[model samples]
Every structure is written in C-alpha cells, then in structure tokens.
Target: MGISRHATAHWEGDLKTGKGRLSTPDSGLMQDTRYAFSSRFGDEKGTNPEELIAAAHAGCFTMALSAKLAEAGHPPARLDTRADVDLSMEDGPALSRIRLKLDAEVPGIDEARFQEIANDAKENCPVSKALSAVPITLEAKLKR
Candidate 1:
C-alpha cells in the first residue's frame, strides 16, 4: 500500500503585492503567506522555493540517516539534522546548494564508520536523489 499527502496554496492580487495561504489538506493547518517580486527580486515576505526545499531536505536526510545508523547496527541515540537550500533567481527556483549539518550520538561507533554512514545518507537520501541536479554539502558530528 502507498500513502499520499497534499497541500494547497491560494493566491490573490498581483505578483509584486499578492498574498496567499498554504494548507495541508490532510492536517488542516493553514498558514498565511505573501509573495512579491520584491521578496523574490527585491527582498520582502511569505514563502519561497528555497524554504520548501529546505523542509524536504531536512525531513528526508533525517530519515535516511536513521536508516543508515540502524543498518550499521549502531542505531543512533540521537540524531539532529538541518538542511539549508539556496535558490538563485538567475536560473529559476533550482537548488544551487544544500548545507546539511547533522549531529548524531551513536554508541560503539568509530569515526570512520560514522562518517561513511553520514556521507552515504547525505548522498542517497530520497530528496537528494530527487534533486540530483544540485550540489549537497554535508557537515556531521558524531559522538558516542
């Protein structure tokens, strides 16, 4: 069986001064948002593509890292991951770079083994696979 999720965004007015709201149809959480050419072009409110990408990256990397740790027989005591996605307007809303920082506490794991798993998770995470056109950089700290 497969599961599906959905989100919807509603926009009104012009691009430079338009506003909208985004909601998770399944969860019923609606967030007020606004987008402008100034924000996209001039720097202004609302949400942008980079923010969405970051959300996806953060969730995907965490799951991937957890799987890696479990597969390696270490099983993380704690894992914290963050991803920062960069978007350059010159080339549309494409991922330019992803900054992934991970902090993991895994018992009985050596540095080499930890690094290998972290690197593999960074490179092979579902979001990473989907955004193969972009470059991803990883910074991981592992502790016993």
Candidate 2:
C-alpha cells in the first residue's frame, strides 16, 4: 500500500493589459554593499521574472562571497554584484545565459586568492545551485 500526494494548479487569463515593458538596466558591474549601493529589488515596479531571478542571484552571490572572505581572514569592506539574466526569444522565450559582474573590496587579499574565493562562491552559492539543472517532483489533484 502507498499514499498519494496531491496538489492543484490555478491560473486566470485576461488579467491585465499585458503591457509589461521590460527594463534592461544598463549594467556596469559589481562586488558588495548593503544600505550602500542600494539594490532595489523591492516593489518590483512591474518587473518580469528574469529581473527577479537576477536580483536574487546577485544577493545570494554577494552574501556567499562575504562569508567566504570572512572565513579566509579577509572580510570585505563592501561587495557590489550584478547578475544579468538574458531572456532569449529566438527559441520561444527562454533563459539563455546569466552574467555576474562583481566588484569587491577586501582587505589584505590578493587578486588570485580573491578570484578563487569569488569563483568558489559562484559555484557554491545556494541560488547558483538552484539555477543549475536539477530534478523535480510533482503531485496533482482534481477539484470536484
């Protein structure tokens, strides 16, 4: 004998004007900050999912980098990170690539070690892992 998990999907069309104008912020770069550069992910301002993903990725990477730096005895003064998620329409609107631009200020850290730590954070960050390919489980139930 086995138990079954259940879930439901819901959606309503014709909800809005569908006038979601995309905002491609002319990205400069990144590496650390807080109440400093002011990453405005709040309110969304009617942004798309791609933008949200980018914001989350950026924040996650920054935090990860901070932890890495501190662990390595070189706590960062600040970190500014920008993650650019590219949405491609060439093949039915898909996420093609993600670019992370980071500008970091760490005391008593060399370029080589900093790069290593940054790469480590990029590879090990929670968000980065989530963005990677993974298996999914699902359950569905019907409404009567």
Candidate 3:
C-alpha cells in the first residue's frame, strides 16, 4: 500500500481576482493560507504554487541527499538545499525547470564522492522521480 497525503484548496470568484485558501488537515502547516492570481503572477504578498513546489522540492532533495550520504557511510553534518522552480509562458504556463543548489558538510567524504551522491539523490528522490519530465539541474558543493 502507498501512503496518502491530503491538502484542500477552496477558490471563489473568477480567475483574475479570485481568492483561495489552501489547508492541510494532517500537518496543520497550512491553515487557510491565501492565494490568488496576483499572488501567482504578480508581486502580491501571498503564497504561490511555484513557491510551494520549490519548498517541497528543496525539502525532499535534502532528505534524499542525507539518506544517500548515510548509506555511503559518509553521513552529513549539515545539508542546506535551495530549490528554484521556474515557471514560464513560452508555449503556455508551464514549469520550465528546477534548479537545486546544495551546500553539504560531510565528515571524511571527498568532494567527488559527495557530488556523486548528490547527483544520485537528484535523480532518484521521490519528488525528482515524480518531476522527471521537467529539466532538473543540481549544483552541489562539499563544504569543508
């Protein structure tokens, strides 16, 4: 069986000015968070889907990297990841690419090995697998 997670979004009115609330009952991390067209396509002070996607990607990649390092017997002391999701309107509104930047500090691991593990995580992480259709790039640095 597979685990399931749920989040709900409620939207009212037309697309341009319509407002919506997004919530996750299980974690309560999001409780009626607001989003709208402006929030998505403009400089509005609210959350957007792309931002959320970036957060999820960053988090998933970080965990995956840690797991990979641990399995390689070079567990990381710290792993900082930042994911950037690019949405473009070339053909239409689409996610063009995702860039993952990782700064990792792992004891007794060479830079080459750390890079190999980071690459593996970027390719095999659950989120990365799910988003395989999108172009994903990784920049991993081993911090001493």
Candidate 4:
C-alpha cells in the first residue's frame, strides 16, 4: 500500500477576504493554523499554501539527497536546502516557478557526481513529481 498523509482546511467566506485554518491532525504540527488573503498576498506573517509547498519540497528534496548520497557511499555531513515558490498574480495567483538551493557537505564526492545525484534526487522526489506542472530549478553547491 502507498503511504498517505492528510491535512484539513477550514475556510469561512469568499476568497479575497476569507479566513482560513489549516490542520494536520496526524502530526499535530499544524492545529488550526491561521491563513488568510492578507497573509498570502500581503505581509500578515502567517502561513500560506505556497509557503507550505516550499517547506514540503525543501524537506523532501533534502531527505532524498541524503538517501541518495548514502547509497553512493558518500553520506552527507550536512544538507541545507531552500525552496521558493513564486506566485504570479497576473494569472490569478498561479504558481509560476520554483527554485531550490542546496548547500551540502559530503565527505568524498566530486562535483560532477554530486551534480548528477542532486539532479536525480530533485527529479525523483515525491513533492517534485507532484509539482511537476510548475517549472523547478535547482542550484546545488558542495561546501568545502
């Protein structure tokens, strides 16, 4: 059977000025977390879908990279990844692009091999596959 995760969204009102709460019951990390139009479009400092997606992507990609590196006999000492989701309001708040920046410290890996493995991890990551419709770019650096 395939693994499954679920989250709940509760909204009350129209899109422009509606209030929203997101909850991840299983993990309890997000219990009735606030999300709103101002938070998404403006500077309300709450959580948004794009931000969530970015977090998920970053986490998934980093983990995948770790696994891949270990399989290749080069387990990483540290892997820092940042994911950015760009929202284009010109087309009604569509996700335009995504950028992933990864900084890694591996014991013994060459640049070419690291690049190949990083690209493979980015391509095969579950979150990346789910968000395949959006263009994704990656910048990976091997920290010395």
- Candidate 3: tens digits of C-alpha lDDT, residues 31-139: 9999999999999888989999899999999999999899999988999999999999998899999999988889999988888889999999999998999999999
Q: Which runs in model 3 stand beyond 4 Å of their true positions?
A: none
lDDT of 2: 0.63
Ranking of all predicted structures according to lDDT, beginning with the best and ending with the worst:
4, 3, 1, 2
**Residues 25-56, candidate 4, lDDT per residue (tens digit)?**
99998999999999999999679999999999
| TM-score for each candidate, following the candidate numbering | 0.84, 0.64, 0.97, 0.97
User: Which residue pairs clash within candidate 4?
Assistant: none
Candidates' C-alpha lDDT? 0.80, 0.63, 0.93, 0.96
Show pairs that collide, candidate 1.
38-42, 38-43, 39-44
lDDT of 2 at 79: 84
By TM-score, the candidates rank as 3, 4, 1, 2
Off by over 4 Å in 2: 1-12, 15-45, 133-144
Q: Give one digit per residue, the lDDT tens place, for model 2 in 15-60.
A: 2422322333334222111111112223324444666678888898
Best-fitting candidate, scored by TM-score: 3
Worst 10 residues of 3 by lDDT: 44-53
Model 4: CA > 4 A from native: none
**Residue 122 of model 3, lDDT score:** 99
TM-score, predicted candidate 2 vs. hidden true structure: 0.64
